[model samples]
Target: RLGELASLSYGLAMTVVAMKTVTPEPAESGALVARLETLSNAIERLPRVIPPRGKGEASAAPPPCDLQDQIAALTSQMEDVVAGGPIERREKAPEQAEKGEVKKKKGGFFVSGAFSDPAYSRFALKGTAAVMISYLTYTLLDWPGIHTAMLTCFIVSLTTVGETVQKLFLRIAGCLVGALLGIVSIVFILPDTTSITSLVVLVGLVTLPAAWIAVGKPTVSYIGFQIAFALYLCILQGAEPGFDLVVARDRVIGILFGDLVVYLIFTRIFPVSTLTQLRLDLDKLIRQCRDVVKTKAAFDPAAGAIQEAGRAYATLETASANLAAYGYETFHSGNRRLRAQANKLAIKALRGFVNALAVVAAFPPPQGDAEKSEALRQLLLHAEMNLQTLAFSLAAPFDVSSGALVDSMPPALSPDDEPSPQISALEALMARLNNVKMTLFHYRRLLHTEAGAYE
Candidate 1:
């Protein structure tokens, strides 16, 4: 299931990238165009269909004849609008192309580069070393019963040491819990169960809850699988139900040994810290938020920008979730508490900024009010520039100072004069932007302090 989810996410991300890379066709209007053409043709044939009105019979002008010219004119105008849309898009294409170029320039590394860094190689190497060590330990020792040690390595390995450690702890805890349950079943429940029906009922009773937990949130879901595993090992030990304490003990020991090996390897060897990755993820998310603002400012459809921002947000959230494993990380520099606090603040601020952008997107620009439209555009531009600076600062090395924080607010538009919905929406967006800047400023300060402590 997790693999399926990952595959879906990857496919969605690729789709978004493709959508951005390919120039979309102008808004679909084939149906409208066909309807207009049919109307125009019918109007052209109308005069031919009607018999000529005799002058001798009441000399009143036919209403259909009178309106034929007007109908034809309206149809022609509609057709022209529909036909000219592509021309308008073609005229604006160069300007859009220039904007796209500017976006690419300002995007920096987070936007243009692959998600994985050079540390990924180290990550792979560490995981391989762990699995190999586990395999050699069990195989050389001729301990076939403890082969689960090798299996554990594969299941617990993750991109960052912190995430690996987190999973390691989860695996161990779940194994212990499941083993205890299995032991209890072997001691008490197995003796009472005689028929296969009774054994089936007993297994179902245990598995029902385990499956429930497995289907729950990702963090705790592994526990359920482990519970079921341990119970099965103890309860079902062949064709028929047989109590096997020795096998259960060996499996549990193998799992624990594997986890220990992985933990040591990941921590001691070129450890990929989640804290560092969290900073990078935060930077990516900030830039994504900036992209959202840029799209809104350019009067472009924001669906793609919003989708990217959402993906970035999820990435950051996952990183933040792994922060708990910092306690298990060895040779870690910087104050973990401060780093976690900074991360939390960044998440909160970005979430607000994304929500505000959504609200801004909801309200269309004021119609026939060029001044108000321009004012909103300026406000969005201001927000975008500030976000860009923040993202850049975040992407910089932690030891390097980020200069002054972004305290300058976007110039406020006079809501009294315009008092339009667009102005109100922009105001809300500015408020959120201010909150984001302040949070980022605080987050950076926290990081500086952490860096100083490490130095």
Candidate 2:
């Protein structure tokens, strides 16, 4: 049955592909194209034919001749092309080979120049220094109880100072909450518990809420695990029931100490600002949007233009998420509030721009209307140019005098124009083009605003 269905699907797809490829001249063979369409539809409605499984089983019925008819029609249409000449294969370009080599060289993690960047090196050294400080504090001071300090450093370390600080805060909050719960269990619950069953019940009670929290959202989930960890340490110190406040105290101190060390080292020495990273991301997104616009202008069905658009959308999503984390960052050099406001405005504009681009891409200009196609192409070109300018502006320092703001309006159609489907699509694209301009204008304006201007 599956085989029959697969064959039918393949036949239908091939029929459709052939229908799209063959452009029958209205004066010459329009009737032939109509017949092919009818046959393609008939092929889709054909019944599935299951083959005989054994010698006694009945044989499957033969398929209809619609497929053969469609193939014959396609071949007849292509007869002129077949008679013209044999097709020639083009050789690969040297530039393309060089590009492929460059892509291959930059593909892996270790070879991606990650260690070459000073910021990455600083981040690495900072984390290593934090762990070493914790390790030495516990070992040299002969404080085995606070050995979890080293573990805490490993758990909370992150790439950026803002991210690391954010994780450290979560770790601290989770640790404190967990420690409190552990202490409470030790005081009230442990005294009443006699058997291992009662102790298990107590631990389970504390663990239930912690597990609930741990499984929650990423921002607050660490609190839940910390709650479980703190409670477990205080309750399950040994095989026998033991209530020692000192163990909980030591673990909590170790976690807090590690956090403090990380915080001071990451923030005070060679700190990587999230806001700076956000700017770079915003720049990359603008360039991606430009590429998307450029791809949409040409609009190739088989050249993976859709994949490029998908990647741009993905970058937009990542930039938005980083903006959210940007709020938690306090280590930026400039007027952090002003930078945040500008970024927020720019991101909102970018969101609208991307959405408008999606609409424009969806309603491509009709292929038969050369004038409308050219007009749409012009609009996309204007948008692409403006996007390129915006990206350049974002890469450098913002300049009020820079002419980043350019007119992005599409050419207006005449009021007395005929009401054709192609014209309507063009009109829709024109409206979206106006929206794109508005967003670009807003983004350009935000970038132009100086720090003092905000004050």
Candidate 3:
């Protein structure tokens, strides 16, 4: 049920991001400090509910906080953690990454598409795959039956099981129900030229709404259309106006054959990690942190913005845990070394990005004397350029090992160089974004790694 929201609310959230409001103008420093103190004290007063320490550990009871209160606590904690004073911030050294290079920089449609989360790719694959299965099954059977191999495959892929099991379940449910509905359509509505055209139009109208309703809805609607199409084909062929059991059998056989293809391809050609996304998402977090750190050059980030970003990383960590589960599920024989390597680097990348971001932000350049990190001073321009590349989803040249790489990049995060109060409280937000990005890549790679599973 909730899965349906992936298409609906997910797109809506993206639309909201495209329409973000500009930061409000700042008042006096005294006013800002008062606000910062208020937020910090509020955060300090809130209840803390830490996660279970290890795998299989029972979760402790959640300490309830109102939305506002929770936001404050996370912000305050992120600042404290990143400040690395009383509590040392966790560190992930860089050399852990740098394994692979960009194989090729894509252009046009592929490049734009890559900037987005890849979960939707699976959905699109379902549709196209469904169409293929239907056409193939019918052709193999000499086109005797108006088969629904395509629609069945679409529905199956809509379900989670990665590919194969998802295909199996959805295909079964959709085809059976569709076939029954096709029978009803034949019983009630004629399939002459006019009627057929009307039926097609009706199918389109029905399916279009579900497309907006969400991804699965379209698949459901497609199944119904396939059912109509199948029975219509039989009727046009002048078959008797009753259920044809033989036709259904033909349909299933063809569908299974096609399903076999997808499954086999997945398990063979490339079996990838669904958790592969963490690397990219973590990469973004690092860039964002770098941006925050540079903010001090022009403007001191509202006292807690850096901390909030760190908190967001913690939330991302939680998502990473779930992603790790997928990692376990997707690993294959003979690929243990690659999987291990990927996971280790992934964790380091995740932590590194978050910590780096927070550190720069928390270490505010003194008022009226804004500079950059000593480790990165020479690389300021390069870092900014790299951040822009990451921000825009471009292929950036990564060579931070040079002795001249700077600690903080210049050019504040906000336009007109305004510091933000929310920056201090984004612990959950970072996690949420990182989680979404990570999950996306995880699905893509795992699907790739197990491409043969669809067969």
Candidate 4:
């Protein structure tokens, strides 16, 4: 009876896999071209913003009107910061400035007194959770061989560390549910090892619901493992002979223990996000912004920038969501400050993202006016560099000095500032952008202060 049931389940799953129907992923190609073209133009206009051959210390920001050299200096600083500029270490963290680093050393791990991620530290807490649970269960029930039963951590621990809780939890849930269902079938329906149709039916049943939920839910990859785990448990696990209920419970506990090990480990390992990945996401937005500009040379790039900004808003939201997941995983004392700073920067970046997009969108195509195009190009380059600096900051754990994270976006070219087939709507947009800079600045400061408080 069990053999026939298993065969039936497997057959149905094969059929589902044969049909490849999945939603289309968002495209990055359209935006890539736009980002490149705008960047090229920005490069050309850079000279106009800076004094061609001036040699001196860089100024903080551009003077509001026609101060091209001032713009250049600001632009250059933006680039340097993004490049990580040599880590001069001039500005101090507010806490360090107040309390001093030496006085605050309490149970902190350090490499040359610099706190960082360590694999052992990250997973240690998880091991505590697991071992405590196991020892307690063993002590209370005296499940035979409790002293020798599953005590060592798996080798997979090192590799799986740093995965999000959502993923870990989803897989854990799927594996547990799948394993139980599999065992139930093996015992009640698949008494024989050589059944085909019954197995197919089982596979199909599990896959159908797993696929649907994975597709519709936010974190879907776990569904992929759900049926796989179910198949493994149903067919293979039946060989393990023991008290049915206790054995199943122990397996569930073991799976959870493994996941917690990985989760705890990831949070602790000087778990820095890569600069390259951060670069990729920002580059994606930049490319999208450029694609809009490419539609028509005379067409203002502001509209495209606005669209790209919309994408960025989504990106930040995703980052924030990820941060929340990390927090829920396991508490690591060292990561506390880094998390505080990152959340602050993400919030600030979102505000800047909106303002920058709107400001760029309001620009006019210069009415066949080459000089105007050149000026707009200069602004775009500066804006892009500012974005790069923001991106770089988010990618690593480094101290930002006073005024480090703050940035003033490039001004939008006004309708009155151009001769053209006048568009009233575009001009009004420019006026609105004039006030946007200060608002964005305010938000950035909020994040900066929040980061400072924790640091």
Which candidate leads in lDDT?
1
lDDT of 1 at 68: 23
In order, what is each prediction's RMSD in angstroms?
A: 13.5, 11.1, 18.1, 18.3
> Relative to the unseen true structure, what is the Cα RMSD of model 1?
13.5
lDDT (Cα atoms) of all candidates against the true structure:
0.64, 0.61, 0.43, 0.44
Residue 147 displacement (Å), model 4: 15
What's the lDDT for residue 190 in model 1? Answer: 87
> The CA-based lDDT of model 1 is what?
0.64
Candidate 2 or 1, higher TM-score: 1
Q: How many steric overlaps does candidate 4 have?
A: 39
lDDT by residue for model 3 (1-455), tens: 12222222232222222123112332234643465566456445644443323333323323312222323333344433323313323343232234454344446756445447565565456556556756776777677444545544444442233334433534455445555545555555534425456666645644454344334442233444444444444343342343455655565555555555555443343334333444455555555455454453344432343444544465567546544544434444366555555565556655655554443344333322233233233333444454454444323332323222212323344455444332322222234334433433453353346432222
Candidate 1 residue-wise lDDT, 189-286, digit = tens: 88888898998888899999999999998767888898898778767778976677888888889999999998888767776666676666666667
Local error of candidate 2 at residue 423 (angstroms): 8.5
lDDT per residue (tens digit) for residues 228-319 in model 4: 65445445444442235545555555566556554545445444332223335544544444433342233442223334444545665554
- Judge candidate 3 against the unseen true structure and give its global Cα lDDT, from 0 to 1: 0.43
Of the two candidates 1 and 3, the one with more favorable TM-score, higher being better, is: 1
For model 1, give the 10-residue run with minimal summed lDDT: 86-95
TM-score of 3: 0.35
Off by over 4 Å in 1: 1-125, 302-341, 398-406, 451-455
- Candidate 3: Cα lDDT at 319: 44
